[model samples]
Target: MRFKIIFPTGYQVADILNDNIDINVVLENGDVFFGTLFTISNLDYLLAISQEPFFYASDLLIVKDLSKKNIRAAIESLVSGSIELAFTKIRSTWSNESGSDSFDTIIDMC
Candidate 1:
């Protein structure tokens, strides 16, 4: 089974599994960086979006909403400058690990 996952903006990251998905990140500083992804929960992700040396869940511009609790925890972890904690909180809620993972991948190859 294949389905489309689209962000609020037109930007889309295809094949978001552990497989490196090609996506462009526009940082808060207006600098655009291009790369394939690891786990989006990785610290590299926080670094990509944040202009600050210390990163947070609030630092994330794109969010994967699972539950209100998950979103709140993600922000709180960032507010505390714990990117790993933020990752842990958000990682649990990522849809890929849930029902989505059971399906065959669907993606646009950039």
Candidate 2:
């Protein structure tokens, strides 16, 4: 599966994140992170640790299309100590599709 992330208004992902194309991946197990997509058939060989953000890809599943206000609210919610709740509020902003994960492409609007 493929996924797209619609970032919040006035929000900008840092330039450092731009070169990390290997990070935009979604696992079949429902883990989500930004970078470039990658599919792994084996989880046993996977080991990752980071102080950056992390969340379940499934949390990105939307209930409806999102608005800018929704995106802003979700961003604000991030500091409330519940990542799941923040993601839940912004779920509408994320979308997924069926596709192969063999390419590296990123669109940086900033």
Best model number under lDDT: 1
Clashes of each: 2, 2
lDDT of each: 0.34, 0.30
Give candidate 2 misplaced runs (Cα > 4 Å). 1-65, 84-110
Best by TM-score: 2
TM-score of decoy 1: 0.22
Q: Which stretches of candidate 1 lie over 4 Å from their true place?
A: 1-18, 39-110
In candidate 2, what are the lDDT values of residues 26-97, reduced to their tens digit? 222344443221122111112234344543344332211133343334333442444444233322222344
Which pairs clash (backbone N, Cα, C closer than 3 Å) in model 2?
Answer: 24-35, 24-36
Cα deviation of 94, candidate 2, in Å: 21
Give the Å error, residue 38, model 1: 3.9
| Candidate 1 C-alpha lDDT tens digits along 38-105 | 34554565576788887543323333432334333434444346333322222222233245432233
Cα deviation at 47, candidate 1, in Å, is 27
Give the total clashing residue pairs for model 2.
2
